[model samples]
Target: MTQTPALQMTDVTLEYPDGRDGTLRALDDVDFTAEVGTITSLVGPSGSGKSSLLAVAATLLTPTSGSVRINGREVTELTEKHRAGLRRDEVGLIFQQPNLLPSLTALEQLVIVDDLRGKPRRRARERGAEILDHVGLAESCSRRPHELSGGQRQRVNIARALMSEPSVLLVDEPTAALDHERSEEVVTLLCRITRERGTATVMVTHDTDFVPLTDAMVTMRDGVLSASAHRGSPDAGSTRRSDRPGSSPG
Candidate 1:
């Protein structure tokens, strides 16, 4: 039996008004998909539209045209309220910064997700604890943001996203603020979590060193997606570090 992709986008295009006379296309007829139990790395330059694709996939920004399906349910036509509900129920977003509330403990951060969903407090706490432990933060449950290191804080962020039990995970520059070692640790943790939870994960990163650790890598340029190559495949070399204009290759 074939499994459907956890997240799919086809012919997606997003345009923003350029001054008053023209439009700037952020995503140009892009087709992207992420399968269950696998992770895909999206690599591109700063202005190459990587974040635009992610925003569209997350339903945070409506595309000018396209079809977006999460767990096989079409979301492009849903109302904002419905789309928000779908996002909350089916998608997990891991931002570059942990942005933890200074006053909230590590576990409390995860519990808040359940609170937003109206889940019972007891069950929320239970699930939050389990997720935190899964991310190797079992002993730091009571620590607040100030008490945790950068890597630990990121782990809490990952755990918090997992609290929703989402089928799809959207990560943006998860290692931007970490040292080389911490970056590798966080990416490895993401890999393990994706496999263990069967989540379809799409991670956007400027770091090419970690791309090979993902199942597949796709390069984006001027809003267009190149063909993806699986890790260790002959064509995988095509996904080499993007050399953006006026910038050194990553």
Candidate 2:
């Protein structure tokens, strides 16, 4: 049996009003999909619509036209409240910055996610501790952001995102603030967690060195997306453009 993709977008186009009558096209008829237990890296220059794509996938921005389905439910036309619920229930967003609260402990950062969902306090703490441990922060749970290293704080950010047990993970430049070694560690952790948790992860990154660590790579230019080489494919390390929009990697 064929399993449904965890995240899918079809003919998605997004536009913003320029001055008065003009409109800037941010995404142009893009189609994309991320299967369960896989990570798809999105690479492109600034202003190439990578952020726009992530926002749309997160249901934070409504597309001008097209269909966006998360776990097989169409969301483009959902009411604002419904969209918010969908985001809370099905999506996990990891921002470029850890953006941790100044006073909250690392474990508190994750516990707050469940708190917002009205989960029981005891259960929330148990789940938060387990997730922190999974991210290799078992001993740092009580430490504040100031006491943790840069990479450790980022791990807290990732663990917080995972607290909801979301099916789709949208990551935006997760390694931008880390050094080479830390970047490698964080990306490796993301790959491992994605596979273990069966989440479909789409990461937007500028670091080409780590692109091969992901399951597939896709590039965007002028709001157009094209397939790139898959990590383990015969043509790996080479760029390949698709004849049409939204071609699957390799």
Candidate 3:
């Protein structure tokens, strides 16, 4: 039997009004897939449509002409309410910034999701502890965002996203605010957690250092996505260092 991809985008295109009597194509006929228990990274320069691809995948943006399938269910044409439920139940988003609540402690941050889901408070607390421990943030469960280090806060962000037990994870430039060491830690954790939980993860990052850690890496340029390649594949040479400033590419 053939397994369906956890997330799939076919011939996806996105356009924005360009002020004049024209449109700017953000994505052009891109076909992307992320399988269960795998992490796919989209690498490109700024304004390369990587985020647009992510938004479309997360069902946050409907494509101009294409299809988006999440867990084998077509979501492109779903009503807003249905899509919102889909997002809450099946999708997990990790923004570039942690965006954690300053008022809530680390564990409370995760428990809030359970509260919103109407789950029991005890189970929420227990589940929060479990995921935080998995992310190595258990010791900091009582700390607030301001009290934790940047990396610790990002860990909380990751843990919170996992609280929903989502099948699809959409990450936006996860390492944008992290240093080399912390970036490596977070990416490694992501890979491990994705495998352990069988989540299909699509992470957008300009940092080429994340290439080797990815199960597959794809390049996006000028609103077009190049076919992806595994690390051992012949096309692996396409994963090169980014010459952009502040980049210590591998």
Best by lDDT: 2
After TM-score superposition, what is the CA distance of residue 16 in candidate 1 from its true location, in Å? 0.8
Q: How well is each residue in 24-130 modelled by candidate 2, as lDDT tens digits?
A: 99988887888889888999999999999999999999999989999999998899999999999899999999999989999999888888999998999999999
Q: Clashing pairs in model 2?
A: none
Poorly placed runs, candidate 1 (over 4 Å): 232-250
lDDT (Cα atoms) of all candidates against the true structure: 0.88, 0.89, 0.85
- For this target, which candidate reaches the highest TM-score against the unseen true structure? 2
Candidate 3, 1-250: lDDT as tens digits: 8788888787778999999999999988777778888888888889999889888988889999988899899999899999998998999999999999999999999999989988899999999999999999879999999999889999999999998899998888888899999999999999999899999988888888877887888888888776556755433212222322364732
What TM-score goes with each of the models? 0.92, 0.93, 0.91
**Candidate 1 lDDT over residue span 1-250, tens digit each:** 8787898887788999999799999988777778888888999999999999899999999999988999899999999999999989999999999999999999999998999899999999999999989999999999999999999999999998998889999999999999999999999999999999999899999999998788888889988777566755423212222332354533
How much does candidate 2 score in TM-score? 0.93
lDDT value for model 2: 0.89
Clashes of 1: 0
Order the candidates by TM-score, highest first — what do you get? 2, 1, 3
Q: Kindly report which residue pairs in candidate 1 clash with one another.
A: none
Pick by lDDT: 2 or 3, better one:
2
lDDT of 3 at 74: 95
